[model samples]
Target: MQGYSAASLKPIFDTHIKNDAQVLADGWCGYNPLKEECPNLKQTLSNKGKNFKMLHIQIRDFKNWLRGVHSYCNKEYLQKYIDEYFFRFNRRNHRKINFR
Candidate 1:
């Protein structure tokens, strides 16, 4: 959502998403406009403890592993690290080296 525009979000709402897609996301203010824009939109508060427990378990685990490191240091490389981590998570331990 950082660089996305309202125009960009319209397509997602308009697309033939399966089963009235349940989008799980943090409470970003940009989505405020979506309530008026998308007729079927459902909003969930991500800060709720129970919801965070289920949704962010893996990301919390990753942060826990870096507990000893300074927060600012991790912030510097956060995007790259999260991308690589998610790639491995999706791969399920497969170690192929080909770049797609």
Candidate 2:
């Protein structure tokens, strides 16, 4: 979101995430307001990214891919790049069927 505040994240959370969906997040104060709406939301200390190794790895890999492939990207189209990267990453094991 534009900022890591409860106000900045609430709208996106309300629109895209179901109230009952299990939401896992770091212990950021920004998510405090969401608990009332999302009963299943859980927060834990990030422990300097060590608590979520795989997630951090994926983020790092995506950044590397963006730097290596695109070199630079316009902020306006950054979301499109992220969507495309995840789309391909999600289907990496099904390449044979992905084209069909």
> What are the Cα lDDT values of the candidates?
0.62, 0.92
Please provide TM-scores, in order, for all candidate models, with all chains considered together.
0.51, 0.83
For model 1, residues 1-100, the per-residue Cα lDDT tens digits are 3466656665676675443556555566666676664445565676556666855788686776456443544577878777766776678656565454
Candidate 2 off by > 4 Å: none
Residue 65 in model 2: shift from native, Å? 0.8
Model 1, stretches more than 4 Å misplaced? 1-20, 25-29, 66-76, 93-100
Question: Which candidate's lDDT is highest?
Answer: 2
Q: What is the lDDT of residue 28 in candidate 1?
A: 64
Mind giving the per-residue lDDT tens digits that candidate 2 earns over 1-100?
A: 5888999998899789999999889998889988999999999998999888889999999999999989999999999999999998999999889878
Worst window of 10 by summed lDDT in candidate 2: 1-10
